[model samples]
Target chain A: MNLKAIWWKLFCVLLLIYVAIAGLLSPVPRLNILNETIRNLYFHVPMWFGQIIIFTVSLVYSILYLLDTNQKNASSIANSKRDIAAHSAVTIGMLYGTLGLLTGMIWGNFTWGTPWSSDPKLNCTAIGMLIYLAYFVLRSSFTDIDKRARFAAIYNVFCYVMFVVLIFVIPRMREFSIHPGNGGNPGFATYDLDSAMRLVFYPAVIGWSLLAVWIWTILVKYREIKLFWNMRMNNPLSAVALDQV
Target chain B: MQAIITLIKKEATIEWRNRSVLGSLLLYTVLTVFLIFFSFRNLDPLSWATLFWIVMIFSSVDAIAKSFMQESQERWFYYYTLFTPGQLILAKLAYNLVLMVLVSTFTLLLFSLFVGFPIHDIGFFALALLGGVVCLTVLFTFMSVIAAKAGKNTALVTILSLPIAIPLLAVIINFTKKTLVVQNAVIYSTDIVLLCSINLLMIIMGYILFQFTWKE
Candidate 1:
């Protein structure tokens, strides 16, 4: 990795370590129905925040892909690099979304009496996840790499628009949603989250998002490495090493 | 504007030429409604509304997929020279929207023939039906284009359309179900506006994005 990436990795690691120790050891407001599980706010909510930012990054890359005119030439600046950046952001963003959902389900089971509720918030997020899953399916059906990038980027833009509708717009319109502020009586039953929780909560969001960006860059680099592997696939010297790895 | 009209006329002539495809689609709709009718012989109002949406969803998928997939790539190559991607997509959207509206209306009639229409405000229900049809048409048309470009993979039609459809469907379903459960009640106009805005957003995106996919 380069100097900037090294700095990012250093910051991500340091921040996450701080979040874990300080977050776990921090004093939390004791309340019924979520006495100790309240700490999950630091863990579960950050995944969602990280997911939204990562997807927004993916959306930016997709727009860049669309704005590019050099898409015709494979080796050009608009070709594989931007395409891979868009793809990497999408895949890692999907991973973060899935993690967010799974964590929410566990937290719900503990606090809400069931792992799955018909809550609009949960349902909409599920829909959002499906939108991205469809993204991957759209990607797999293409055989030409360049066309794959173009079509998938178009679909990515469309998916992000719909995802915003489902995740953010729709939930706020209804009053019955279980999510805080929009539904269920404003911000976790009107008892404001304690100041200490906000301290870890804000940093966890930053730390987790940095980790996502770090992973996203790794995937971007791996795309180039994989391209190299594909180029060298027929070489006898590389065959044994590839097989062993 | 001229390009879109001529392309649409071309699409119409092609659609009319393929009578068997239309016949099979009607058959598929009838069979699906009949199956739902047999399974739930007497459905409650909510169930009836849900069933109607389900039947219409499948038929719209079939109808729109046929519009995109029926054209062989050789034909697409011809059209590529003849019209721009924006014109081609807009024409296809227009044709499929008209086709789905007809199909959904017929499905509603056939579906109610078996299950019965428990909807109180037929006017708003029809409005919701039209809005739902627009959503389905715009979405499946966009998705079918993506699927068609990916080498005419038909299975990708449903896989790609559902996630996008489900959220929009939730709004429509809730709106439709409200009419079913409470007679002559007004659903929040905000929802209707949101739905319309979704349709508007989709067409705008289609207009902007089809150019990139149009590249050879």
Candidate 2:
């Protein structure tokens, strides 16, 4: 690997180490009863944070793709960059979404007295996850590359808006939840989270984000290779076509 | 203005020509309303109103998806209408709004006849219905466009529409509760304003984004 790749790997390693040490050893003294259970927050919240970051990256790439398509002198480099960014975002977003659901389920089991509830927040999140899952389903259903990408990009934009409404707006509007500041249930403020918790939480967010980016980079490279193979398969006479051009 | 009028007229004409589609939508709406009224026979006025909103929203989805999905099957006509995606969206929104209003009113009327609940404030109820219809139409119009290109149009439309529809659902239910249970006009006035804001936002966003979505 190149120097930049090596540096990223080192950065990720250090982040993982920091999260491991901080999450285990840190004394969240403010959370008197919950104790070690509060540590799950470090992992759970970061997964959502990382998912939002990846989704934002995906949206940026989609806007770029739309603009690039309209341009007469679009650079291959720009197209490649947009492709890499988009593929990376989707891959990372999927991972974060899966991890978030898993961690949230565990957290829910302990805090809410059940693994799942009909709370609006939980329902909306389940719906959001299913929507993204449908996004991949829509992508796989199409055999045409150009059509798949275009359709997926449009769907991504639509889902992102829904994500905003469901995750952010809807939960805040209704007062029916065990989550923080929703209904009668006590939340983070009730816990009086210690400074020590903050120490782990911030780093966990950073670590998860870095790991997502690292995984995204690898996935983008893999996608590029797959696309390359597909193109070569489709255009057996590409060499002749290139010679004529 | 003329373009918009023509587009609206064209959409109405197209919809009229497809009598089966319109027939199915109307039949579905009527059946849903009847089922809800039958199932919730013992429900209080508040619960009845809640069920009514649910039926209306789902039925609106059935009607609006038809209009949006027709664009994909008639690609040439859709492209020809591209001289005005905003006007086309508005026209679609207007048509769907009218359809939703008719369906909601008919369902509510049948609900009153069957369930025998007194509507305390007819004026507030009318305002709530207007707000709810506008919200549903604007929201579903955008959803219809998104679902138009989806692999399974029916499933995708439902998935994509539900999340956005929740806010509208929440507002409508709250308004229904206020009107039917508490008989409070003041509570629903705020909700009606919020619903109107949502309608305005959906329209502006739809106007801006429909171009991106509608491009061939």
Candidate 3:
């Protein structure tokens, strides 16, 4: 790993430490129903932000894989880089999305009287997970390696369109979305998460997203090395791959 | 242009020749809606609206899943050179849209016959039906091509489609809920806009991605 990436990982760790301590202990606005649970704003929302950013990175890689399928003097690393980035980003992104959903459910149970409230945002995230799960199912169904990646990339792009609609359009269109934002009412921007909360919330989002990217980079590097090692394994007497490790 | 027209014509002729398939699908739709009515007995307007949509969603999925299945291997190879991927998908989409419109309208009729009409806004209700069914057909057709190309497994087809399709289902159900407000002919601008936007997004995605899919 590069020194720069290590520094980023260190920064993410430090920032998350600050978020965990401050997020729980900080003085939050004591609104009637929400009361203490407003602290979840710093933790839960960042998971979603991180998930979306990671998924976007995954989608970018998939697009690159598709566009570069027919191009020039592509090194072996560059060729497989697309699959590595897309696969790892999706793995980490789904992790964040699942964690976000669980935390949101817990927070909802405290504030909204029920964990499984029919909030449009909650439903969208749930469906988003299902869509990605289907993407995995699509991947496993294919026996050919290159073919699987091609189809997965295509599905990834198409499904993201639906994902965009779920989060952005549907919640805004509905009139009772329960998300404090956009259900015929002004969204999270105009209300909810007062300035006091934004202090932790913004940093929490950045830290979590940076952590996700760091994990993703590690995954990519590991895969790249594995590819290099496999190439070296063509000659059994070679210890060259071990030197890189 | 001619390619698209010819493909649509071919799709229609084949569908006509295979009348029993369409007949059986219609029979299945009738039975499904009827069984639902018998089980529920009588639903409130909202419940009825939701039930009607549930039936249409499943039936549309079943119907559109067949869009890419009818071609023989040799026919597919022959047509591969005859049409661009865009032209092929456009024709399939157009044909499926027509099929969904007819089937959905028939479904609405059967729903009224069996389940009783709960709709207050006939105008908005039809708009929702048209928009919703078109959305269903577009999505499942796009997914159908992908599923068809992947492995042609029926169960896998539903698994392939359910995630992306459910969000559209949720939006349509919510839109239908608006229509059941006990008011006369109420259609909100916002709901209409949202439904249209979802449909537009699906159509554009289908157009863009089908080329990659059909290349397989």
TM-score for every candidate vs. truth? 0.91, 0.87, 0.86
- B1-216: candidate 2 lDDT, tens digit per residue: 777778778887897888888788778877776776677667677677777788787888887877767765577465565666777777778778877887777777777777766667777778888888887888777767766766437766776667567655876777766665446455565676666766676677677667666555
Model 2 segments more than 4 A misplaced: A1-5, A30-33, A72-84, A141-143, A165-167, A170-176, A180-194, A239-245, B72-78, B181-185
Candidates' RMSD to native? 3.8, 3.8, 3.8
What TM-score does structure 3 among the candidates reach? 0.86
- Model 1 chain A lDDT-worst window of ten: A236-245
TM-score-sorted candidate list, best first: 1, 2, 3
What is the C-alpha lDDT profile of model 3 across B14-68, one tens digit per residue?
8899889889889999999989988988778878877888888788877888889
Docking class of 3: medium
Ranking of predictions according to DockQ: 1, 3, 2
Give me the candidate number with maximum DockQ. Answer: 1
Predictions' DockQ, in order: 0.64, 0.39, 0.55
Q: In candidate 3, how many Å is residue B104 off?
A: 1.6
Please provide, for model 3 over A1-245, each residue's C-alpha lDDT reduced to its tens digit, 9 standing for 90 to 100: 46354787888898899999999998876667778887888888899899999999999999888777645433334656687789888989999988998998899888788989777677777788988989888888887666777788888988886778666766543557777665565544555556776777888999999988888888877877886677687777765555554
lDDT of each: 0.80, 0.71, 0.80
Report the lDDT of model 1 for residue B120: 75
The global Cα lDDT (0 to 1) of model 3 is: 0.80
Better of 1 and 2 by TM-score: 1
Candidate 3: clashing pairs of residues: A181-A187
